[model samples]
Target: MTTSDILRAALVGRLTENGTLTDAAWAKAATAVPRELFAGSYFVPIEGSTPTGYRTVHPADPGWLEGVYTDQTLITQLDGRTSPEDAGEQSVTGAPSSSSTLPSLVLDMWQRLGADAGHRVLEVGTGTGYSTALGAHRLGDRNITSIEYDPLVAARAASALRAAGYAPRLLTGDGLDGDPEGGPFDRLIATCSVRYLPMAWLRQVEPGGRILVTLSGWSYANALALLDVTGPGEATGRFLPGYTSFMIARPHDRPPRPVLALLPGEERASRIDPAKLDTWTGSWVAQLAAPSAERMGSGGNQILSDVATGSQARTVPDAAGGWTVVQRGPLRLWDRVETAIEAWQGAGEPQQDAFGITVSAAGQRVWLGSADGPGWDLPV
Candidate 1:
């Protein structure tokens, strides 16, 4: 066997051991699919220190090619363009337009879906059609419906799937609407992260059907929720232990506005000790959770906020061995942040891990540790 084959076996082993895939069908699908064919010229290298980062590798390099195929993610499209050719010289800024999700996560999501040979599945964000191919392999192409927002990507994935002998119905449209023509699906899986669950998805699935999606909010982490449609317009689920980051689907090609634009300017200010800003305040939490927010720091100087509005903020160490928050906001949002810190400290310096996400019939809530007890607040 080739090195790629060996890596593929290892990945399958991990997936089976992790309980992400159990059936012989899943193993056959994993082994049959040629992962490198879907992966573009480059793949995003997985880093130990960071969740994701990009590293360019030539297609001819056997080691890199095997690594890309076996380890999981393949950066199919950078930014909004499908391949480097379409992106021209501007590819660096495009972000990840399409990718083959990590194998373990893909199996985990598929396992959560509990799909069978007879089930009808609607997969959102058909980037590269690798997952669609896997589903088609398990359930057959006639039972799968895949949607991709980008026409270019949709066309390529359609062609790729057909070439692979799995001709699932492929649609190029906004997946948020959940292909009405293909109604009443047995399972709906969103490969992308969404700020809110689309009502159409909830309405389209049969009662008691499962809808698996990644819900991102104003928090540092995103939650993978497995919700069951209990009623006409209700679904409930809690945070899954793992986290993932996916491109935000937008109607237009342009990216969403920056988060900093929402904050008041630094000039409109009240003075406060920067050391007192609580990182756990609702606003900061909200900012961290914002989809537009991106990390802009290298170690200590790093900042996290929207790049468009230029709302930059960071934390630095002081002589006293404490951290100071340095922020530039129009209304001295930093001052409010300091007040929140004081409130938290006055109550008690809460340790980090005490935070937990609570989901109820009404909505989701985030709780923080406090001296008296756990303090809870609603997510906006």
Candidate 2:
């Protein structure tokens, strides 16, 4: 067997052992597909670099093939422009715009999607086309339509898919808009996270179809949501178990912000531990409360700055007791967060699995325990 085959087998074995690659069809697809072909080149983050820096890795580099086959998300692009080829041997720093998501997460999501052999699938954010290839292999290339927001990323993915001997429908445009001509797909899966469930996806998917996506926000906390389209412009589903995150959809990402100048407005004692905002589900609750606020810092010294209204909330440990929060601007960022967190705590401090989302023409709201339970309206 070739070295590639050995690495691929090991990956499949690891995934199967961990119960992620359960279906025989998905296992076959994983075994057959060469991850390295799509990877071509990727970025390795430099350790302890301010603003985070990445160094490129090429095919000629030792352990490149092994790294490709490893179950890890590999950064492919930065700042929506720079790629490994562009950076060459230099260490560059920028927010990651594209990546090859870890194999285990990809396959696990595909399984959770509940796609069958003959189902037509719409895939968003075809970063490396690796996930698209897997889906095409399991569901047939003719049944898969993958869209990429970046033209260059799409072109590279198309080339790689061709090289891998698979030809799925590839489109260069916004994945959020989806494919108008290729409507009514049985399954719609996004590789990126959206701030709110897009109405277009609800309209495009057939009734009873499934849309599996990660719900994220300015706070950066994410949870996987699997919704079943019940009717036109409506769907309801629960947050899946376990933590899943993806790069925010480019269009849904927060707008550019000016330098923050902390201003004083109101001060109060924090109702809940400000450090709760640092936990996974707590941060998610905080996000639900202040959807437009960008969160920074951590633990006792948590900072929240609102993007739309210029509202800001900063928390620090109180010298006398627990925590104190200072707020300014129109929105009481900390008040909302504290209220939401208290509600979540009142609901017994459940994990993400206890949360579910409902979408309608009125708006979408993510609820805890049940649809009627304490819920937060998505900033739709």
Candidate 3:
């Protein structure tokens, strides 16, 4: 075996030992595939003499080839297209469209799925085909159906999978709808992040089946949940501690709106207690609780209010790096919130640790905490 092969083996071994891969099937899959073949020119390499930690696409170099197969990430596409040719030869922007997810994260999510050979799996987001290849290795190609939103990416991934000797049924379409033709799957795994669980996936999968997805809202964390499909259109599961991020897959090809433009004007120049503003509110909390809020800008100049209720206020920085808050109308809410945050911080700068969503027999609750104790709560 080559040095790259040895490194691949060690990476797979680490994943297996870390409880991410319980069955030997996944390990075998990881070992059998040459990750470099599916990777793009730019890949993160192992640390060493070739400036290994940097991203490079020098195909001729031995280090580059080795970097391709290592258990690190590779930038396959940027901004919905193949990376610029010049970028392949130089250090450039690192916006990633698809990649073989970090090994540990992949293994953890795959294990969470608990797929057996008999299982029929529908995988959303066929990026580098690495994870799809792993699924095929475990459940066989005939039983795997993978979807990719980008037609070009879907085609490239299909070709790569075939070249690697694994051919699952690949589809170029929105994964939100799923492949209706391959219905009643035993397991549905989404490698992409989603704002809300698609109802179509729930409708297509068999009752008591599992759906593992990276819930897109608040906590900014992934949840590996088992969906019973108990009712006609409802499924539920508690959140699990898994961290992963994927491109947002949508029906259209348009890019996301810039964050700065989305900020409300009232929030442009407002005073805020930095401590209160930094509380462990769930991801969606900001959007829901403070719809027109903006994180304080530099040198505090302007403050924003909803105008209708003025319940929330936003402050921006002034010429110097100082914050200001302005409040008006019915909602003198910002002042109270600022005070609460300052009070909490005065006690101590509490480090908020685990924040997660809970869905079970009782109901749904979102909780936040640090090493100390619970800090806040929100209902879903």
Candidate 4:
């Protein structure tokens, strides 16, 4: 086997072992699509970095093939503003804006989506178009419509799709709105995460269809949701197991803010462990409780800053065994976070899979355990 052949097999093998790729058809399509063609030059995030600095890898880079073949997301753009090619050889700092999502997740979501022949699909966040190519390979190019928020990214993906001998109806627009003219689709999958379930997607997909997405927040906490469309403007589904997240859709991203100041606040004893903020599920619950706050710091020195009202919550070691939390401004960030943490603990510290969402003409709610259980309203 050639290098691409061997590396491709190795990557596929890993996903198969991990149960990320299950079907024979998806496996075949993944192997056939040249990932390098879609990711001609991608970015590798620098370890222990800010703004997600990237190391560019071109087709000429000795490790380019290996990097492309690895079953991991490759950062493609930063701050939705700069590309690896634009930064030359030096590393630069900016948030990751786009990526060729991890091969495992791309295939896993596809496997769960169950799109097949005769199925018309709508894909949001085309990115590098690798995932779209996989869908095109399975359902045929004519049956799929992929939308990208960035025209430049869409154009690059479109060119690569054609070079690889496949073409879906690639368009440039706000993917959060779905394809205004393309759906009533059998399946809708978003490669990017959203703050809430977009009603537009629910309305456009046919009843009994599936919508695979991630519910993300300003705190960067995210959970994957798979909804079965029950009727017009409605759907109900549960959060799938395991950890997976994508960048927030551009339209749902938090607005610009002034530099954060971690000054003093009203000091008092904390009711919960400060380390809970580092716990995977605890952080998720905290996000659901205070949906508008951005968390910072770590361990005993954690910080929560409200994005809208500029409220602040800072934690430190107390004279006693517990933590001391300080709060400032209108909202009580730590109090909300503490309540959520207690709720989760009271519910037996359930995993992400225990969560589910119900979307209707009224609104969407993410609940723990059941539709009537502890829940939060998702901004629709």
Name the best candidate (by lDDT). Answer: 2
Q: Which stretches of candidate 2 lie over 4 Å from their true place?
A: none
Ranking by TM-score: 2, 4, 3, 1
RMSD (CA, Å), each prediction: 6.1, 0.9, 6.7, 1.6
Best by TM-score: 2
Q: If both were scored by TM-score, which would come out higher, candidate 3 or candidate 4? A: 4
Q: Could you tell me the lDDT of residue 52 within candidate 3?
A: 32
- Sorting all predicted structures by lDDT, with the top scorer first, yields 2, 4, 1, 3
Q: lDDT of each model, Cα atoms only?
A: 0.63, 0.94, 0.61, 0.88
Deviating ranges (above 4 Å) for candidate 4: 48-52, 263-265
Report residue 240 deviation for candidate 2 (angstroms).
Answer: 0.9
Candidate number that wins on lDDT, 2 or 3: 2
Weakest 10 consecutive residues, lDDT, candidate 1? 262-271
Pairs with backbone N, CA or C atoms under 3 Å apart (clashes), candidate 1: 79-94, 79-95, 218-289, 219-289, 264-330, 265-329, 265-330, 266-329, 266-330, 297-302
**Per-residue accuracy of model 2 over 110-217 as CA lDDT, tens digit each:** 999999978999999999999999998898999999999999999999999999999999999988988989887999999999999888899999898999999999
User: Model 2, residue 195: what's the lDDT?
Assistant: 96
Candidate 3: residue 243 lDDT (0-100): 39
Clash pairs (backbone) in predicted model 4: 51-94
Global CA lDDT of candidate 2, please?
A: 0.94
What is the model-wide C-alpha lDDT for candidate 1? 0.63
Comparing 1 with 3 on TM-score, the higher-scoring candidate is 3
- The sequence of per-residue lDDT tens digits that candidate 1 reaches over residues 1-380 is 98768777777787777677677777789887767666656644446525454555556655666666565677767757547454343324446778778877776688778788788889999988888989998899889999999898888788878787888989999999998888788889988876667777877877777788765543233556677777755665544554455555554222444344333233322233342222333333333233344544432333445444455455555566555555663333334344544555564654333344443345544445422333333332
Task: Identify the runs in model 1 with alpha carbons over 4 angstroms from their true place.
Answer: 1-7, 17-20, 44-55, 85-94, 217-220, 251-380
